[model samples]
Target chain A: MPDVLAEALEQVQREVDGAFDAFLPVPEDTRARLVEAMRYSVIGGGKRVRPLLVCATAQLFGVTRQAAVNAGCAVEAIHAYSLIHDDLPCMDDDEMRHGKPTLHKAYDEATAVLAGDCLHALAFDILTMSDTSNDPFVRAELVAALSRASGHEGMAGGQMMDIVSDEQEYDLQQVTRLQQLKTGALLAASVEMGAILGRVPPEGRTHLRAYARDIGLAFQIADDLLDVEGDEEKAGKALRKDEGQGKQTFVTLMGRDAARAQAEILVEQAGQHLASHGADATLLVELARFIVKRDH
Target chain B: MPDVLAEALEQVQREVDGAFDAFLPVPEDTRARLVEAMRYSVIGGGKRVRPLLVCATAQLFGVTRQAAVNAGCAVEAIHAYSLIHDDLPCMDDDEMRHGKPTLHKAYDEATAVLAGDCLHALAFDILTMSDTSNDPFVRAELVAALSRASGHEGMAGGQMMDIVSDEQEYDLQQVTRLQQLKTGALLAASVEMGAILGRVPPEGRTHLRAYARDIGLAFQIADDLLDVEGDEEKAGKALRKDEGQGKQTFVTLMGRDAARAQAEILVEQAGQHLASHGADATLLVELARFIVKRDH
Candidate 1:
């Protein structure tokens, strides 16, 4: 990885961790356990890729680092909460995430559920705060973009498709659409929210949107590749479940070589979209490259 | 109920149902089941008390019925989602709500969890839309208020306390604190969001906040009483579960008669807080009285 890109990722991870820590103070009451569960999941682990995306995109238009990080934290919160729910005994029933016991396993299933819910609400709370942006328009638009990406028409809808995948046979197009909603929506939203924080108008966001779309797809294709061939210790969670369950994915549908090739091509195209930004886009361009190349 | 209050409640219920119906359209693809689950839980049932509170308070500031109803719908979405999660087997583990099978029981646990999450995201989605409030400030504030009320510091946190109540011997103050977060926060947020739509600043909302607080406590007290003395058929779900679990409650802590008396007193006090609005507050006052008097 490029030094600048690696450094940016590291800084965002730390900032997001600090922000979550500050925002969620354990209350001196019985509610402490719930907050503790939330903190346990949110404050650590994971690669903070979403926050890196937000900060990288926001930097294009001179948005403040604090503002970008705050918005990034909001998106990360949504991502974290979704992971919590996705790992529940009633859902994926996974016991490990980021190499630790999933929230339900760490606490109880009920605490896991509530912690996920509280984190879900906290995403909007963070976006709506003045700390995210001094302008109400920016804050409102951030909330709109993030919420839309998180809702039934977006991530949750995709999740439903995933849950049903066990019983249904989906074609390549269907799987792509499902992945687009399930994993792509929030990834796209991370970039869009950063643009919103920078006060980028809708007309001015076309390239940024395209860039996000390309990387979103590439990110998932790479994920499929990882699940098929990556080391479980490095991946920090169970992999190959899709193969075990006979679920169709990019790897299963397109073959391993084609999936890798497609992800690389998408990442290249993602970088091309940022060409208009010149040198200022270095981190974003590198981030795209890293998305497909990362071991995890 | 007085003719006017009954008519207002009827209208709000119909409008809320209509709003949710319009907002959630079942898709024509693999994601259809998820949307169906969300629609099933949100479109019907419940008293629509939160919506009524929003409309009643918004009316005090001459806010349009449509705008108020939209904001009210946002709050109702949160309320509906909370019920869905609360009734999950891992949570409250109930099989019924609002006279119908709970989402998990009707569908599956994963679907129910996803539906609840989607609805939770949808609340913020509705609030950020221009249909809820055209002003960006209003939209942002609405998101902030609703998210805060729904999150750890409020409803979800209260739920955490309730989950632990089975093991902990909570006194009256502890129970009150728990209920305040669990139920009072959302109810109060309903009134607060309505006031926000009407452009009522925080300082101008003191009386309305007090009114909401009073009725919020009264509402829970009534719920506790109903749990002890009301029929299961009318309540539309299990009754005496708190007693069955030997959990502390307003009725258990205060005794049935004192709980009843306290609710009535809170109702009267809630009405008094609206006295400054004269006859214009009639609907809100009646709603408060109904909070304590309703069988369900």
Candidate 2:
């Protein structure tokens, strides 16, 4: 990873950890179990990439670091819930995440499902309650954007399509549409949320969204590449599971060389979008490159 | 049922149905499936008790019926999601609800789960999107209240307690605590949401909450009684399943006679709270009676 990108990741991880630490106050009854489940699911450990994107996007729009922290944490909450539910027996049926038994394996499936549900709700609650955003309109916009991105038309819809599309042939456009809704929606929302907080102009918002869309696609391509070549332990999952499941992937549609070429193009495009915003986005450009080149 | 309560129930059903029909747009892709699941889960079934309370509470505060419609719909959405998830294999494991095969049985479990999750998210999305309330603070309050009621400290937490308690003996206080959190939280939220929309004074909010809490407990008591005396076909579920499962219930904790007596007292208290709001709450008082006296 580039030094700047690595530093941003470290900073995001630290902030996310701190933010989550303050959540789920110990209820007088069942304090231990509830807290443990929350901690286990969140502290289970991952790349913290979503939170990093949220923070980086916010920073790109000249928002204070604190202004973006809760939004960053909220995205992490959504990400964690998706992982938990996805690992359930009726879903992906995975027993492990981040090299540890998933929440259901650690707790019971019922508790894991409830935990995920609670976490999903909590994400919105946290976002709505953020103290940093003084403008109610800004807060409302942030909530609306995130809710849409997380709801049926975005992430959930993409997952449904994925489930229905398994083992089916699809062209690059279809694949791009799926990846944009599934992965890019939230990433784009993160940037938009930051821009909203910074009160960025409409032109800046458009550029930020373009930047997010290109980087989001590049990130997915890199993920596909990693699954084909990355270490299983570091990836915290079975490598090539998508291939095993006969799922469509960027590399499957485009040859590895072509996929790599496309990713480079997207990174360059994202950087160009950032360039108009001046030096403030220098690190964001580096982060985009790092995201498309990382092994895990 | 009292004539007024019967009329209120019919009105609430029509209002809720209309609200849902207006709010859920048919997305082009998953329009059929989404509408099917939504209609199956929502229309032509189940008591409209929660929505009625929302409408009634708003009436008590002299808010226009149109202002409370979205809040009413939001509560029903949460209620539907709870029923769907509760019937999952890992949760209550029930196959029936409202006299029909549960969502999971009607659809597949994964679809049911996703539908429930989507509905849960959709409720808040509706609240955030609702233009009925011009005050942003009121909107935020409604969102926060609903989130708390649904999250770990409320409905889901109460569910966790229920799974843990099972057949274990608990004192009356503990049982009441469980019921309050599990069933009462959302019921209370329904009433509170109306107040939020109406922008009721703090004192009025307290009285409205008391009215809801009493009716909520009475509603649960009536449900327990239905399990004991209900016809299998009419209830649309297997009667006595609660008894068969050795679950802790109001009927189990207190004898049927005592439980019935408690229901009467709760109804009276709810009526008393409504009295302060005058004849405008006449229908609400009758609704409370209907809650305790209903067969199914």
Candidate 3:
């Protein structure tokens, strides 16, 4: 990773962790368990790639770092909640994540479900707070962008496609559509929300949107590659389940070398979209390159 | 039920159903099933009491019916999603809702989880749209109110308390606190959101807040009463499960007669709080009474 991008990632991880720590103070009552479960998954873990994306994009428009981080936390909350629900027995049934037992495995299934829900609500709650943006329009737009990316037509819809992937023989086109909704949408939203917080009008966001789109697809392609070739310890969770389940993936559909080459080329294209921003876009450009390079 | 309240309920029910039907158009692809499950739970069933609360409160401030109905649909979406998740096997584990198979039973657990999530996201999506309110502050406030009410410190916290109720010996105060978070918060938000949409300043909302608080408690007491004595067919789901699980409730702690009387007293007080609005508050006053009177 470039020094600038790595430093930004580390800074965001600490900031997000601190924010969640302050946001979720475990109550004295039994509700403590629910908040604890939420804290467990949200406070730490993951690469903090999404928050970095938000911060990097926000920096281009001179948005305040605090405001950008707050919006980034909202995106992170949605991501965490999706992971919690996705790991449930009825879903992927994963036993581990981020080198720890999944929420359901650590806590009970009921607590996991409720914690996931609380986090989901927390996403909007964080966005609407004045701390995120003093301007109500910014806050409202942030809420709209995140909700659209994560809702039925976005992340959840993509998840449903994934759940049924084994039952249906999805081709490359179908898989691309699924990944676009499942993973691509939220990644794109992270960049969009940052621009919204910066008061960037919809028309001015084309380059940023293009950058997000290319990276989102490359991120998934890299994920597919990781599933087949990455070490379990490095990934911090189960991998290769796609192949074991005989689910069609980018790597399964395209040859291994071709899939790897596609991710690199997409990363290259993603960086080009940020060329308009020049040096100010250095972190974002580096981040896109990191997407395909990261083992996890 | 009073004629005014009955008419309002019927109107809000139809409006909310129509809004959801419009909001969730089943897609042609695999996502069709996810949207289908959401539609099944949201498009019909339930009392529509929450939506009516929003409409009645908005009426006091001369908010447009279309705007009020749209906001009401947002609240109803949150309510519907909660019910879908609450009925999941890991949670309440019921088999029926609105006289039909629960989402999980009608669909599956994974679909139920995703559909509930989609509806949760849909609530914010609806609020952010211009149809709810052209003013971005109103839209942001609506998001803030609904999210805070439905989040960990509110609805989800209450749900956690309820799940752990069987293991703990909860007293009347504890039960009240639990119900306040679980059921009362959303009900309170319904009224609060209506006031928000009408641009009612926070200080000026004292009486409306009082009305909402009173009725919120009353609603839960009546729910406890129904759980103990209401018919399954009329209630449209399982009943008497609180007693079966040896859980402490209003009916259990206060004695059925005292609980019934307390609910009636709350309803009376709730109406009195709306006295400032006089004839304009007729539907709200009647709605309070209906809370305790309804069989379901």
Candidate 4:
């Protein structure tokens, strides 16, 4: 990781953690099991890559760091909730994530389900709260953008596509659509949310959105790459499930060398969208490259 | 049912259904099965009680019927999503609702999960859309109220407490708290959302909230009473779930006559809260009385 970018991300992660801790109900609450599961899933693990994107994109328009952090927390909470749901027995049924037992495995299935629901609700709670923005318009935009990215036409829809993968044959176009919905939507929304918070007009945000799209696609390609060749300990979960499930992926469909080439091209293209911002977009440029290169 | 409330709620139900049908992603979408499940759950059935709450309360302040309809759709979607999740194999594991197979029973588990998620997202989507409210502040307020009512410390928390019920012994207070979180929160929020839509000030809305709280508890007590005495055909879903699960309920703890009397008292108190509003609150009062008397 580049020193400046890594340092910035590390700081953002801490701030995001503080926000989660502050907002989440503790284990002593009436629904202690659900709260415990929620806290466990969100408190101290995973790279806050989505939150960093929000912060970096907001910085381009000189928005307040606090505003960016609050929005970032909302996105991360949604991401965390999705992961918990995805890891459920009826879904991916993964036993581990972030180097620990997944929420369902660590607790019970019912508790995991409710915790995921709680975390999902918490995301909107964060967006609409007073701390997110002084302007209710900003809060409304965040809620709208965030829900669009996570809803039926976005992450949830993509996940359904993924679930049908084993039973249905998917061509590259289909796979691309799946990846775009499942993963790219939230990532793109993260950047879009930052733009919204910074008071950027809708049309004014085309380039930033383009940058997010490229990197979002590139991020998935990188995950596919990691699934093929990464270390399990570093990755902190089961690897090569795509291959085992016989699912179509960037590497499998495009071949390893071509897939690697495509990701590099995307990463480079992602940076160009930030060109007009010059030095203000440096962290974003670095982050885009990092997405395709990070081992986990 | 009273003539005014019965007619009003019947019209509100149609409007709410239209909003849901208009907003939901169709079966032709990529994850068509999940969409199908969602449509099956939300399109045709249920009493639409929550939506009625929003509409009736909004009427108290003369808010637009369209605005109330939109908010009603939002709350009903959340309620639908909760029912879907609760009916999952790991949760209540129920086979039927609204006289039909549950989502998981009608479809598959994964599809049910994704459908539940899609419905949850749609609730927020409804709030943020311009058709719901022209004012962004009102939209933000709706999102916050809806989420707080449904989230960890609210509906989700109540669900968690419910899951622990079979495993642990609980007294009346604990049971009441569980019922409040699981069921009362959303019912209360339905009334609250209507007030927010009408731009009713927070301080001015306490009596309306009292009205809702009273009815929310009454609603649950009615359900318990129905479980013990209502006909299976009229109720649609299986009766006697509390006895089957060995779950303690108002009827189990308070006994049948006492529980019935409590529901009646609550319904009366609920009407009393609306005395200041006179005839404008007639529908809410009628609805409260209807809760204990409805067959389903």
List the candidate numbers ranked by DockQ, top first. 1, 3, 4, 2
What is the per-residue lDDT of model 4 for residues B1-296, given as tens digits with 9 covering 90 to 100?
77887898779778877877788657564688877788899988989999999988888788888898999999999999999999999999999899999999988888888888888998998899998899999999999999999998799889988888998877888888889889999999999999999999999999998988898888898999999999998888989889988998999999999999999999999899889988877788888999989989
lDDT of each: 0.92, 0.80, 0.93, 0.90
User: Per-residue lDDT tens digits of candidate 2, residues B151-234?
Assistant: 887888888778777636667788788889889999999889888878886676777888889988998888888999888887
> How accurate locally is residue B282 in candidate 4, as Cα lDDT from 0 to 100?
77
TM-score of 2: 0.95
- Model 2 chain B TM at 0.95
Q: Cα deviation of B214 in candidate 1 (Å)?
A: 0.6
Off by over 4 Å in 3: none
**TM-score of every model?**
0.99, 0.95, 0.99, 0.98
Candidates 1 onward: DockQ, in order: 0.95, 0.59, 0.93, 0.86
Candidate 1 lDDT over B187-258, as tens digits, reads 999999988998988999999999989999999999998898988888889888989999999998999888
Candidate 4, residues A1-296: lDDT per residue as tens digits? 89988899889989998988888757565587778789899989989999999999998888888889999999999999899999999999899899999999999888888888888899999898887898999999999999989988899999998998888888888888999999999999999999998899999999998998899889998999999999999999999999999998989899989999999999999999888999888999999988988988
- C-alpha displacement of A216 in model 2, angstroms? 1.9
Worst 10 residues of 2 chain B by lDDT: B26-35
lDDT tens per residue, model 2, A1-296:
76777888888888778778787665767535655787788863877877777777788667778769888777788878888887888878887788888898899888888888888878877877757476766666666777788777777667666666664576788888888877888888877777877887667588888989999899989988888888988877767788898888899889789999999999999999877768778777887888887766
Per-model chain A TM: 0.99, 0.95, 0.99, 0.98
Shift of residue A65 alpha carbon in model 2, Å? 3.2
Model 3 pairs whose backbones collide: none
